[model samples]
Target: MIKLLSLLALLWVYMAVVGATHTADLSRKSFPKGFLFGTATSAYQVEGMASKGGRGPSIWDEFIKTPGAYFSFFKHLLEDINLMVNLNFDAYRFSISWSRIFPNGTGKVNRKGVAYYNRLINYMLRKGITPYANLNHYDLPLALENKYLGWLSHDVVKDYADYAEFCFKTFGDRVKNWMTFNEPRVVAALGYDNGFFAPGRCSKAYGNCTAGNSATEPYIVTHNLILSHAAAVQRYRQKYQEKQKGRIGILLDFVWYEPLTRSKADNYAAQRARDFHVGWFLHPLVYGEYPKTMQNIVKDRLPKFTKEEVKMVKGSFDLIGINQYTTYYMYDPHTSPPKDLGYQADWNVGFAYERKGVPIGPRTKLYEEDILCVQAYSNWLYNVPWGLHKAIMYIKERYGNPTVILAENGMDDPGNLTMSKALHDTTRINYYKGYLAALKQSVDEGANVVGYFAWSLLDNFEWRIGYTSRFGIVYVDFKTLKRTPKMSAYWFKKILRKNK
Candidate 1:
């Protein structure tokens, strides 16, 4: 519990440095009619009972024994939906764990697992919340990983498509929005290139791991991921989308890369970063090939899609979900190429958080006036709202103005703060204010942006970071599994009010 003095000090910090009146004049009224507002959570992140309910082990299930968000979502289904209804949210974006549906990744269906998702979807519909379901969210079935090395081999592509088809047959009637995969780039890079996440694999030179080729595995994994995504979309379109009338897409994470200076080298370096990041996945989905920068640099190391695969891969989505978070300054490293090459090393660029001495975004303090703060929640997230604008515009101009959704956008707070300090999330409120304003500006300038969903609705297991950071507007007490709305939630409630 926070002492009275600490609470007073926090309140004073907000009122004095970060004025309480900084909430912008923005609301649902500020955007186009039918714009979506929702919060996102992955299955492994929130829906506990990882081993129960006939659910098979995801790679995540076997990797970590430290449980987070282990409270039964199946037991508290109604309470969660009620919370969404009270907040005036339009939708809830959640992933269906692949192993939950098919315990062994293939062969047998888990009836209990199907029932759990059906209950969750039905409750959301009854509460007037639209369901936006993602098929995969970095939670691959352990069975697949053990079978043919998961995404490393081409065999898993057929299995993934089969699983996606099963979900369409079972749940497509109610779930209108479908995403094949969430951040396949992250899956390839962090899981293979750096060995940072679950099913950890990396070359001996890059990280401590039993096995993996940092140079080749990342590319091969990404190739299989793209193939899996396209195959799923193909099956949905050919078999279910016509009857179900639902749109399917893939979610990709993008960070706006600004050149540190006007020098040609730096500008090219920044482009290389963008090409190697989002373009790694999206370029093929749009143009039927990898980015020129990548093809020229990595050459044979980067996989190529055949003539038949090219036809299947191009124009694969009705929409694209871009998860915009922060911005980084890029500069030419101007160093000799290392003999040890990896996915990130292929970019050949240097990342800078600041230019000269001034910071790109202000370093996080207890409070700041101009809404410039960096490293608030995680090391990568900076409070540069303009990054959202630039990211959306880039998608528009480069990708032929495709329908876009600002899918996962939000910052986080420390998990150890007392209830009083945690509840008063002024920094978070300011974050939404600035980003939403930038999103509105993009729409005003003719970007075909459709929806926005926050990074999460509740604090849950955040991959390698675990529960050390809280990214939700609703605070969850880990001990009792009780959820209390933080000030940011109320801020959302106020702006989203029908009268406002």
Candidate 2:
């Protein structure tokens, strides 16, 4: 805990110093000509007035309202929505909350919800900025969670198709780019296995060891989510292709996994980790099936698809959205596997966490000397920009050079500083510089990377973390609802202008 605190303190100081002295040579450092630069946000995170939009309660609404929840009674969504639209966002990527549109998750269209997003979308277009929209971002209607198996149920595939069709029909004419889902793995893991985020339910001990639902839920949800994505893609291709001429795909969050040692055991462990993480989604879309290693490891825990289903899922996407953050080191150690055959065993096959070496340079303070460091806000996010480049390269090699759009990537600072105050965020600027350089390298090496969208446009509700961690390029003053563009925002604008 002290180490974490020290890391945060160093980050704050580093940002303060860098923000003061940071200035890029716009002539020397610029993005490729025509590369798109933008910022992203999610619906549940920024759109408040959940009840006003003919929006029925989502699991998030219920989760936040729980007695001891972090965002309970916190109305920061409207503030964020207003700040995002009224601020200096060139291209804004956000999601349409499911329950907000179809109040009960199925049946009727929520006119108020439709009006709210229509207003937001039109507002962005009026500002001369294109709106990149996603259909779902980890928030399911409470009604759906109650009636169906959530993503765990196969029925969700059709229901999700219906929802996607509705959105494409309603907004596709204006919104050119559409994402089917955002980081489904995180949703499945948090909702089912860990029970840390929402719909918290941890499986009880059956015989001797405690089991986690997350282990199996992902396989189940992936099966459904992929089919749902395929169905949506099918609808788009058949119904709206000639009319809208829009592109649709899924946003996959990937992390580069490296073996700790050159030994065969460690190498094999690293391979297993990669297949389990990236291949979980990529395989179904690319190869029409889940990773073979996942099936070999988890055995029956993974869901099987019929031949027809595989055909439906395989080769269905028009593009792939990569959302990478950090890298993880994998090591193999001699140990017994877990007793149960559910989720915990997914990574328990003598696999252990290994830390990677941090680069030593003038920015060493931000770079923890050890492999595994702490994040300012989320425990899972460690500061590692190099991983982003490696992830893009891996996608290129594995998926046959698919046109990739970096959907979400950014740094999170602990300080509750607004954009006006975050001007001194040198650490963040450096972080972006390093990652952007890596991405540029990937493009030069033939990665077919087209655009980059920073993780967020403004600081908003960070799900379970509430609004504690800020990843916005433009800072939001929660109290006054003021939006201020940070130095990074200025730097991004310069990069975008240079590219243009």
Candidate 3:
């Protein structure tokens, strides 16, 4: 009886403290009339019934199975689909692992795979949540990756269009928002150029210059990806849009680049970085060609498109989904001739490595120090909330403020589940608060920012980082496959309820 009384007392104090500290009522901030507030996940990350759905192997399947693949430590894959569907997400954004839909990536349709996705989509709809489906999310069929040079081969574009059409025909009526690709830049750079991701191959090292091969492979892959996206958009516009009344767009992941010193050189370098990162994809979709900066920077290193191709690429999206994480500082070259004058020359500029200029929060210097960027389980993710705000503003200013959906954004930490899973996650909470506040500010300033979807709904396979990093608001015990919502989850739920 005494212990129960004490527990009640503590809970009361906790609620009082929370009320005092957090002022933004999520319930009051209900998304713009028809706006969405949900969480997202990917198929390969959460759906572990890899072999059950007649789903042929994806690059992830092969990558994860490799002897010393980064995430091999978590042998807890092959999770049950029933359990995953019930994981308690407001809304879930996942991909249709292409291999699962077309086991061979082309001719035969995998009925079992189709049924599995149908089940998942039906379950979400039944739960009163929307299903934001992506046609591809980094898990290309291994057969395509090997037989065709994946996205490098223009044929894969047609194959992808067919696959996308299949998805629309199958799930278009039920799913309202369809994303053509999750993050094409990451696919091209990580999978093709850096050789860190699956089908890992450095085009420069291989010297496999087939019709589509060159140092320009990343740009070429992007061009084909754009073509594939356009084909899907065009098909949906013709066949499904009126009947389905759904929206279609492609999700592009971007990192904001700022000039380290406001000099012409630094500014030019920063612009170059943005052009390569965001413009490489956006310019093609919006303007019918790649950015002139990228063209000039890469010179002949990028592939050229005919006039007809340009027409096909432009104005192809109903909306643009952007996934932004961090911002970087750019530096100018000291030498006369720009360092390498190669495709990747601009990335040589320095970054905002130290947290000197970052804005501050109420409690800690960790929040203020621009030098102490939040590190992802993967070295690539450096956290900068203001970067997200800057990114949204840039998109609004540069691209005529298209309806922007923040498709993915979150931080990751790898440690035992303890207080870290509970109250101590102020870092994650602060990150969201700061970024959301900035997003809210953008909306107030007339940027057409429509929605924000946290990067993950649960902790699952984090690609190369494997299960080492946990980014989910709900803690998933890999051993038991039990999901316990973290404090952040509770907080976000409150925010959602208030916003609603």
Q: What are the TM-scores, per candidate, against the unseen true structure?
A: 0.94, 0.85, 0.84
lDDT of each: 0.87, 0.71, 0.71
Please give the distance, in angstroms, between residue 488's alpha carbon in candidate 1 and its true position after superposition.
Answer: 0.5
For model 2, residues 295-339, the per-residue Cα lDDT tens digits are: 787788777889888778889888888887666677776576656
lDDT of 3 at 164: 93
- Stretches of candidate 1 exceeding 4 Å from the true structure: 1-23, 67-69, 365-375
- Tell me the deviation in Å of residue 309 in model 3: 1.6
**Highest lDDT model number:** 1
Q: What is the C-alpha lDDT profile of model 3 across 1-500, one tens digit per residue?
A: 97666556545543433443354644425346656677777777777767655768887777668422222112332232222334333556777889888988999999988887787778667666778899998988888978877888899878998999999999998998999998998887776665667666554444332223225666777778888898889889999999999999999999888887779988988887888888889988887878898766576777777888787778888888888877667776664534323235434455555436552222221221122213344455555566787888998899888988889988776634353333346556756766777677788788898777887767777887777778877777776677666767777766665321
List the lowest-lDDT window of 10 residues for candidate 3: 361-370
Spell out the clash pairs found in candidate 1.
Answer: none
Report RMSD (Å) for each prediction in the order shown: 3.8, 5.3, 7.1
Prediction 2 global C-alpha lDDT: 0.71
- Model 1 scores a C-alpha lDDT of 0.87
